[model samples]
Target: MARLQSSGFFDLGDGRLEYHFVGRQPAAAPTLVLLHEGLGSAMQWGALPETLARTTGCGVLAVSRQGYGASSPVSLPRPADYLEHEARAVLPRILDAAEVGSGVLIGHSDGASIAALALAEGEARLRGGVLIAPHFFVEEVTLSAIRRTRAAYERGLLRTRLGRWHADVEGAFRGWNDAWLDPGRRGWTIEAALTRLTVPVTLIQGTEDAYGTRAQIVAARRSCPPGLLTVRELPNVGHEPHREAFADTVAIIAAFVRRVLEDEGAGEPHRPDGAPMGE
Candidate 1:
């Protein structure tokens, strides 16, 4: 039998984002807001959300950003700062309109980069972050993989596979692909924002990941408050650690969220100034 899922759109006025609110909510616990990968959507997360919510007793709100999934398409040839722009302009509004209030951010790939940006910019709604295969800065490996994928996209396989998850597949593909391939975007880095973030962050990536190196986590750890950061390298895993090593990934994420929330509840300052970051 086919299972039916219920979902709705968050009308942000500027854009309508496809999202689904499901899983357990203990009231005392914060929600787990999930951001999908570049070509991902609310549907691409598969059963991970349900599994996490059940295990952690946290509410789960999975968002499909504009130009991906069922959400509206964005303007073409995205700015070099689109990820940062998303953090500053779009995510906060989504949090506000979705009534997410506050939550832990669990993001993958491009989504992970966006999560770090949101944390850096100080999303009061974000208590912590779980970044998987996050690219803090562009690298040769990153472009190489993307270029290879672009070739595969031209062969029709990539587009066909991504089409299953995206509503505007071409828009999503071009928006993410073209922006990264732009020469000017090579200098882009969200590392500077890390200095402003004090939240507990778990940076997990597989050693086998072709797109980015462990240096991605190293950069984050170097930039973020040492005491607030955790780095985990999953051996034998690929880019999608959460999916490749589901049990370990979920456990690490749940523990990080719990510990951070407990410390915050016990009155530890989330930021050095005893105020939210990015004032």
Candidate 2:
């Protein structure tokens, strides 16, 4: 593994957000912003971020959301407005503090939703985005899986493994699980909001993902500005494609980022059929 670095925290008003920076900084390469899943923390990513950073030559910023990892505990139930806050409120501050003028965003699951919302306004600094196992709409299977996960946490060995990553595994689990299962959140769909994003986006989903279906990809393809979007479905993979097929995930992302940057330096910023960046 590339030499790993110590993790730290950034005060974001409500709490201090935990994060880790990997790869050589102040390098002649684009920055790569990484957002973890609902139950993820900086440590949970393990060696993936470091490996990707070393290969891509991009400085990696991997972060745990407010209520997860070594960050502050969630004081209350997750707000229905959490995703919105992540986009409009939280992310800008993070980018500003990091001094990330422009780069790519790699978001998984809940992180994908957050990235979609955050990139809607199209910061000029943004190069592109890669979303893995993103969740825009809920599936019956997903809720069922979450229920199963809760049971496993209670009766199975889920706690033993998760405890190593999260300072308070219960806080992380309840913050995501409870908010998602809340009946009021059932109708939450971002198809309309996502349609407004102009950034070049690549959505990756597993063919076997039980939490989402082809309908989710179809919605994203139809909603996003045409041609600027790409979708890749990996066969025989599940919800956590990055974990199940790590090399493939990294390869696709690396290629997409390099291509976007190359196109930006050319005349147009997208394929002929797709809309330009920030359209």
Candidate 3:
């Protein structure tokens, strides 16, 4: 199994983001970079990082963006185009700071949307991506869920639960919730970005997700290049498939990572006897 190499703060000159690094990547192998959901942090990923490293035989790096976890805080009422800004600007810097030469982005929810944008806009050495519960456009179901979340936050239940992981729970909640629920941002959609992706992508969605619907997958299938995208729908699973269907999620991701590497002729890490390392 891959062991945890380090866990600490990563200084971005302007901010200090928390991060966890697992295992080690060889020169030819790709690193797995995990991006969390809107209200998630490096700690929120739980054991998925270590499991991915062990199953794929690749290094795993999970980082918390600014305004969440132990990272720096942001001003209130974020702009409607914040997600786009994150994709085109912040993500590239994170990759460069981590010194990731080649990578497969594994992102959940809001993170998934960011990954899609990065792939479309261009991130050198980005091999491919696995997007879980991504949102391409604003949906009424998403808004309804956010409203309920806001209610819970006002009652203090949600805040108490999220406070365990986030240093500034209010900032974490408002930064994501307020921006997404803005009426002026209702037309937000990344379909144009999806159309520009040149690398392979796997999109996973739960059938019972409260925040989105099958429309998301349909839009992705319609927009992405033919034969470049793969879709997986989990039966009876909720939004957090990584936690709800841990083994199945890991298996699917591991297979995709291996296939991408093989297609790129990057191959897999080998043992001393020349057999595949993760076999």
Q: Name the candidate that leads on lDDT.
A: 3
Q: Which wins on lDDT, candidate 2 or candidate 3?
A: 3
lDDT computed for candidate 1: 0.82
Model 3: CA > 4 A from native = 1-5, 25-28, 270-278
lDDT (CA) for every model shown?
Answer: 0.82, 0.79, 0.87
Worst 10 residues of 3 by lDDT: 269-278
Candidate 1's TM-score: 0.90
lDDT (Cα, tens digit) per residue for candidate 3, span 1-279: 223347877677888888888766435357888999999998889899888877777888898989999999988889888878888988888777777778999999999998999999877788899999999999999999999999999999999999999989999999999998888989899999999999999998999999999999999999999989999999999999999989889988988998988887777754333468666
What's each prediction's TM-score? 0.90, 0.90, 0.94
RMSD of each: 7.0, 6.1, 2.7
Give the Cα error of residue 228 in candidate 3, in Å. Answer: 0.7
Q: Could you tell me the lDDT of residue 73 within candidate 2? A: 89
| Candidate 1 clash pair list | none
Steric collisions counted per model: 0, 2, 0
Cα lDDT for residue 40, candidate 1: 88
